[model samples]
Target: MKILVTGGAGFIGSAVVRHIIKNTQDEVVNVDKLTYAGNLESLVEVSDNVRYAFEHADICDKEAMERIFAEHKPDAVMHLAAESHVDRSITGPAAFIETNIVGTYVLLEAARAYWSGLNEAEKSSFRFHHISTDEVYGDLPHPDEHPASAELPLFTEKTAYAPSSPYSASKASSDHLVRAWLRTYGFPTIVTNCSNNYGPFHFPEKLIPLVILNALDGKALPIYGKGDQIRDWLYVEDHARALYTVMTKGKPGETYNIG
Candidate 1:
């Protein structure tokens, strides 16, 4: 299969690209804007592979995205490009809104156009996999907040959308757009909302890497509000595998909560 992965230079996106290039026979075309968080250095291991290709392009650019679709003729798309930092989103929401919401909208259109041009068999197998976060479900009840005897549940596939931060809200909006395209246009789209990911080559702005890097340097670890916010953590490699499994084997027009 020929797959196009947006934001393939970032943490999780790079993981996905590496998994595809190393473990599978599929070819990957990575489309990334190369933002501060999106570093090409993350994909150094797989960069030399014949199955892997990188494009320094933003998903928000409609013309460039269209050209990419025509040029690569990808069989599937894994949409992951966005401004993902919650603190950054709180300070500057415009980037999150533009990149997450508007960018996803544009990518969906571009992918749909490409999918429409395929043959019946290719169209049936083509997929638009929108990768999103579990933060879109808002804050789950932590065990510390309640008694240890009380049931602390995980975010399920049916969890209601209650995004608190701008970043999560933008992701929620993109998820909706992806679903809308599937429902209205018969596009073969699948949405996956996963837990927090932490692993190698992670950007320094995020909590896990920041904590580890700061602790090593004897710098203060900035905990948000007494270090009580709990999140379901998944290793980046684990997430990439789960995403690939779902994309290749998932049912059309169905939402799978991959964590």
Candidate 2:
């Protein structure tokens, strides 16, 4: 299968690209706009693979998305592109709104147009998987603040959307768009919401990486008040594997929570 992965140079996206290139016989076309969050250096290991390709493009560009879809003729598309930093979004939400909300809209339309012209077999097999965050469900009371065994306050698939930050709100909008396309146009779209991820290539804006780097550099670890936030996290490689499973074996129009 030939998969087109948007934001394929970013942390989690790079892991997905490397996983497919190193482990599977399937091909990957990486589309990224080379934002500060994205680093092509992370993909160096798989850059030379026969089944890997790269396209420097933004998801917000309709023409570029359409052209990419036409050129790659991919069997699937995994959308991981977005302005994902909460602090950045709070300081400047325009980028988040543009890339996460408007960008998703453009990509969906472009993908719909491409899918409309596919042969029966290709259309039936095609999938558009939107990668999202658990943050859209919003925050729960910090588990550390609660009693050790007081049910652990978790957000399940049935949780209501209450995005507290611009970042989460934009992602929530994109998730809604994907589902709307699935219902209104019968687009073969799937969605996945995942917990925070950490592993190799994680940029330092994230707490874990920031603390690790600061500690290694002999600086004090920066911890927020009381240092008691209990955030769920998963390894990047594990997340990559789960994404591939959902893309390959998941049913269309279904949503999965991965961690």
Candidate 3:
């Protein structure tokens, strides 16, 4: 199958692209806006591959999205384009709202329109998978806040959303839109909310990479929110594998928690 992956130049998105190109026979159409966080260098390994195609475009641009869908004729879409930094969102949220929420809406409509024109067999098999973050579940109780004997509060797939940051809130909104499209329009959509990811090719803006780069420069490692907040971390390649599994085998109108 040909999969059109938005944000395919970003960290995790690039990892997904590499995984698909190197591990599978499927073709990939990489659609990225080349935002501040997007670096084409991450995808250099797969750029020369015959099955890999790259499209430079913003997800929020309706005409660009429609053109990409028409040109690529992808069988599936893995939507991952967004402004993801919480600190950046706190300082400037307009980009987050535009890319995360509005971009998702635009992509959804574009993909839906393309899918609607497909034959019955094609429509039945097409998939639109939206990738989201676990942060939408909001803050969990700190380890110190709970006694050792008490079970630590963990977020499940069914956890209620209570987004704390502008970034998370925007993601939460996009998640809602995916579900609504599935319910209201019978779009073949699936959502996966995953934890923080860290691995090779990660941009320096992320905590682990920032710390690593700063430590190399003899600078003190930075910490946020009392340095006591707990979070889950997943390897980027592992996350890519899980995403491919979901895109190929996952059912529509279903949500999964991935880590």
Candidate 4:
């Protein structure tokens, strides 16, 4: 299969690209706008593979996306392009709105048009998987707010959308757009909301990477609030495998919660 992966130069996306290129026979077309968080060095291992190709383009460009769909004829799409940092979103929300909401709309429309033109067999086999963060479910009961004996809530597939930050809100909006495309247009779309991911090639701004790099430099680690917030952390490689499984085997219109 030929899969087109947006944000493939980002940390988690790079892991997904590597997993697919190394473990499967599928071909990959990596589409990334080369944002600050997206580093091509992360994909150096699989960049030389014949099945791997790269496109330096933003998801918001409808003409570029249409051209890509026509040229690559991808069998599946893994949408991961977005402005994901909470601090950045809080300080400047326009980028998040532009990328997460409008960008998703552009990509969805392009995919819909391409799928509409495909033959029945090809159409039925195609999948559009939207990757999202678990932050859309909002904050779970933190350990600081609950008793030790009390049962803590985990984000399930049925969790309600209660985004607290601009980043999460934009992602929630994109998630809704994906499902709307499935319900209103009969698009074969799947959504996966994953927990915090930490592993190699992670950008330095993220908590784990920041802490490690800062500690290495003999600097104090910065912890937000009281530092008691609990989070589920998934390794990037594991998250990549889970995403591949959902994209290939998951049912359309289904939302999977991965941690």
Candidate 5:
């Protein structure tokens, strides 16, 4: 299959691209805007592969999305483009809203149009896999906030939306748009909410990479709010594999949680 992956130059997206190019017989069209967090160097390993193709375009550009769909005729789409940093979102939310919410809507419309033109067999085999974050479920109870004997809850597929930050709120909005497309238009869509991811090629802006870089430079590490907040960290490679599984085997109109 030829899959188009948005944000394919970003950490997790690059991992997914490399996974497909190196491990599968599938072809990949990497559509990324090359934002500060997106480093094409992360994809160096697979960039030279015949199965890998790259397009530098913003997801919010409807014309660009339409052109891409028409040119690539992708069998599946792994949507991952977005403004993802909480700190950045707190200071400037417009980019988050524009990229995460509006961008998703544009991509969905483009995919719907392309699918509408496909043959019945091709349409039935196509998938639009929406990648999301666990933050949309809002903050979980920290150990400091509850007794040791008390049961702690994990974010599940059925978790209710309660986003606390602008970034999460934008992602939550996109998630809603994806489901609405499925229910209202019979779009072949799947959503997956994943926990924190840490591994190779992670941008230095993120916590794990920042801490490692700072420690290497003999600088002090910064922690948020006494360092008591908890997170479930999933390796980037594992997250990539899980996404591929969902893209290929998951049921449309279904949601999966990966950690």
Candidate 6:
């Protein structure tokens, strides 16, 4: 299968690309905007693979997305592009709205149009997987907020949408857009909301990497609100594998919550 992965140069996206290239026979078309958080160097391992291809483009560009669909005719799409930093989103939310919401809308429309033109077999096999965050489900009660004996819950697949920051809200909005497309237009879509991810190649702005880098430089490790917030952590490579499993084996119009 030929898969087109947006934000494939980003940390988790790059992990997905490497996994697909190294472990499977499928081909990959990496579409990334080269944002500060996205680095092509992460994909150096598979850069020379015949099955790997790269396209420098933003998901917000409808024309570019259309061209990519026409050119690659991919069997699956892994949409991972977004403005993901909550701190950054708090400072400037316009980018999050444009990339997370508008970009998802544009990508969905482009994918729908492309899928409409495919033959029955191609249409049946095509998949659109939207990768999202568990943050869409607002902050869980920390130990400080609740008694220790109380249930420290997890964000299940059926968790209600209650986003806190602009970043999470934009992602939640995009998740709705993808589901709406699936229900209304019959677009084959799958959504996954995973917990925090940590591993190599992570951008320095996020928590784990921020701590690692700052500690190396003897800089203060900034913890948001006393660092008592709990998060279910998943390794990037593991999350990539889970995403691949969903994209290939998941049911259409069925949302699978991956962790």
Candidate 6 C-alpha lDDT tens digits along 1-259? 9999999999899999999999999999999999888999999999999999999999989999999999999999999988888999999999999999999999999999999999998898889999999889897776677778878776788889999999999999999999999889888999999988999899877889888889999999998787766678899999999999999999877767666
Clashes of each: 0, 0, 0, 0, 0, 0
Sequence-dependent TM-score of model 2: 0.97
- Winner of 1 and 2 under lDDT: 2
Superposed by TM-score, candidate 4 places the C-alpha of residue 219 at a distance from the truth, in angstroms, of 1.0
Residue-level lDDT for 141 in candidate 6: 73
- Please give, for residues 42-135, the per-residue lDDT of candidate 1 as tens digits: 8899999999998999898999999999999999999888898988999999999999999999999988988888899999989999999998
The TM-score measured for candidate 6 stands at: 0.96
Candidate 4 similarity to native, TM-score: 0.98
lDDT of 5 by residue, 63-154 (tens): 99999999999999999988989999999999999999999999999999999999999999999999999999998887777888878878
- Assess every candidate by TM-score: 0.97, 0.97, 0.98, 0.98, 0.98, 0.96
lDDT of 5: 0.95
Candidate 5, poorest ten consecutive residues by summed lDDT: 139-148
TM-score of 1: 0.97
Which candidate would rank higher by TM-score, 1 or 3?
A: 3
Runs in model 3 with CA error above 4 Å? none
Off by over 4 Å in 2: 144-150
Tens-place lDDT per residue, model 4, 1-259, is 9999999999889999999999999999999999898999999999999999999999999999999999999999999888989999999999999999999999999999999999999999999999999999998876667788878768898988999999999999999999999999999999999999999998889999899999999999999998877789999999999999999999999999998
lDDT of 2: 0.94
Name the candidate, 3 or 6, with the larger lDDT value: 3
